[model samples]
Target: MTLAPRLDRQPRSALLTVVMSIGLIYALLPLVWLIISSTKTQESLIGSFGLWFSGPFALFDNIAQVLSYDDGIYARWFLNTFIYVVAGAGGATFLATLAGYGAAKYAFPGKRLVFAIVLGAIAVPGTALAVPTFLMFSELGLTNTMWAIIVPSLISPFGFYLIWVYAAESVPTELLEAARVDGSGELRTFFTISLRLLAPGVVTVALFAIVATWNNYFLPLIMLNDPDLFPLTIGLQQWNLQAVGVGSQPIFNLVITGSLLAIIPIVIAFLLLQRYWQSGLSAGSVKQ
Candidate 1:
């Protein structure tokens, strides 16, 4: 008889490893360049190789300039970004959790129609709605205001869908019924029992919403004309643009430093919440 193939044998394992290694390097190149570029002084930044440090280290100097330039407007932008993420992302997470739980557990009139609408909305890119949203906000006199940015960000279709799927699978119907039979009111049962079970899913959705709101650029660009109301994304972009026009003052160092600062909070959030995200992904993997 012909020899049987070994159970541990894998064809193309080396090829797969090589491909993944290349992808990892490709993904990291820009971030590495940004870090190296941020450490260089303005003159050195323009003259030196992008991926390596050159001359004296100016990372601390660049950070100080980024925070203090234009009468400390960057601090205001940082505060504004914090507000947007707290209000917009926090509200989105809360609302999506409620809606997703209700949709998964309750039978209501027009439920299917509502799901259909949400699915359609998810399929439509946010850019496609930006013009209409701007026009509507303009009519309502909300443009150039923080409300313009925060309001639209409060709706997250993808977060809703993720929670819906997670909740449906992770929460047991019998447990809910048992709580109801024990004379617990719906809200009480949900708060005491269901919410605990849904922690991973909720945290997963919250992270998604937070990241989306934090990185939001296009809607804020169209909605807010006031630099005072700018988030870090818009504020950094303004600094980048200053280098373009006539009589331009290129503050590339500030822009690079500010970008690095903006990335820190998001990275920390992911690091802190990754356990919940991973648990949510693997929730139903094993059968009891």
Candidate 2:
């Protein structure tokens, strides 16, 4: 009886491990394939195994073609994306930080109502609002312009929510009280003291806003018709469509390679700035 006691439990454990491994592979397989496929040529993509490289290695060649093709349009797309992220995400983070701090620290009439609206807004999906946003922008004649993308990006409900919670917990009330006693203005205290402590949360929110703006395809696709104003996501999709279109030149390798290259900057940013996130999350945990 003792010898046969645990056979069923062992099978369940083994099954769970197997299922988790399969799930991980399912999630990571596409990324692995992208890395492999980027090394291939267009013909090799159609004729060769997808998960492995075939034909002469063309990673650098594909990158060169992607950069040099279409009058260096991809470069413009990169620059556009950079500008959008900086202006849009940067503004959103600034607004969210101040609003969240105010919500957490100040007492004002209708404050709870305002937060209620913001929380309700957080539950609303961006895609669902895209149509209304587009129509509103169209009326304002902001369509087909960079502002269409940037304006919407500057209104991040989720960022506001995150910083609200972070500011409440991470910012010390004692520090603010002391600053007030020293006759420091609210703006001075925010910029000098609170902002320093809010570092981890600020970095976290900025990273989120940047990623959202960077990967936003639907918004830009709906708002801007000009190919020159396209971000990398829309630009890549356009290339993808042209590849599949009748009698169009197939540049599958360049498209795939461009995508892989497009993501590297975000990855680099996260890697370099994550240290601040750790410190921010740890802020105001201890008091004298």
Candidate 3:
């Protein structure tokens, strides 16, 4: 009987392993191509195999050119991306956490209505709102400014919804009540007691916000026309456009190198914050 069970499990395990391997390959294939292509020169990129390296490695040279081109404009784009990601994502996470906690824990007038609105907002695609957002920003004379990007990014309905769901399930009513009974103000209780418990959820929401803001292209593209104010995505697109039009432009190399550089910060962030994700998954599993 044990042998029969083992034999049955073997096929299932093998199938799972195969599926996982396929998925991993699919995910990593593009990154591998990027790395290989980044190492190759412009001629090799066109003439050589897509997946393999060819000719002299020009990784350092390509990186240098990417940074030094156009008076180091790529560096400026990098800085703008950092500002948007940090300020926009961080602000969005904070507002979402506060709003979510209120929606989850407190009884207020029209609370359900407020949550419904948030849900509706979450359902609406951000792309759909870009035109209207641009119009509004233009009206307010905020277009082509950093605030134009940061302000719109601050209002993340999905983050709020995630935190709302997490807060309801992960936080204990009794704990808040105990803190209140101990004469702790609501704000203090929220900041000290509840916030600590919500750390995992907060981290998860922040990661989502950061990734969303970092990858955002269309909104910034529409909002800001100034090349100097452009984020990496839009700036890279501009470079790509220039490359296509001009004679003997190193467009392909710049695109590949810039893309690789753009992804580094996000990868580092996920690696560092991944522990919080694991902890969040395991939270509330064991009773204290």
Return the top candidate by TM-score.
1
lDDT, candidate 3, 24-121, per-residue tens: 99999999999988998777788789798889999999999899999999999999999999999999999999989989998889988888998899
Query: Is 1 or 3 the stronger prediction by TM-score?
Result: 1
lDDT of each: 0.91, 0.91, 0.90
In Å, residue 5's CA in model 3 sits off its true spot by 7.9
The per-residue C-alpha lDDT of model 2 at residue 11 equals: 38
Runs of candidate 1 with Cα error greater than 4 angstroms are: 1-12, 284-288
TM-score of each: 0.94, 0.89, 0.92
User: Which pairs, if any, clash in model 3?
Assistant: none
Tens digits of per-residue lDDT for model 2, 64-124:
9999999999999999999999999999999999999899989999988988999999999
Candidate 1 collision pairs: none
lDDT of 2: 0.91
Instruction: Note the residue pairs that clash in candidate 2.
Output: 200-280
TM-score for model 2? 0.89
> Candidate 2 at residue 175, lDDT?
91
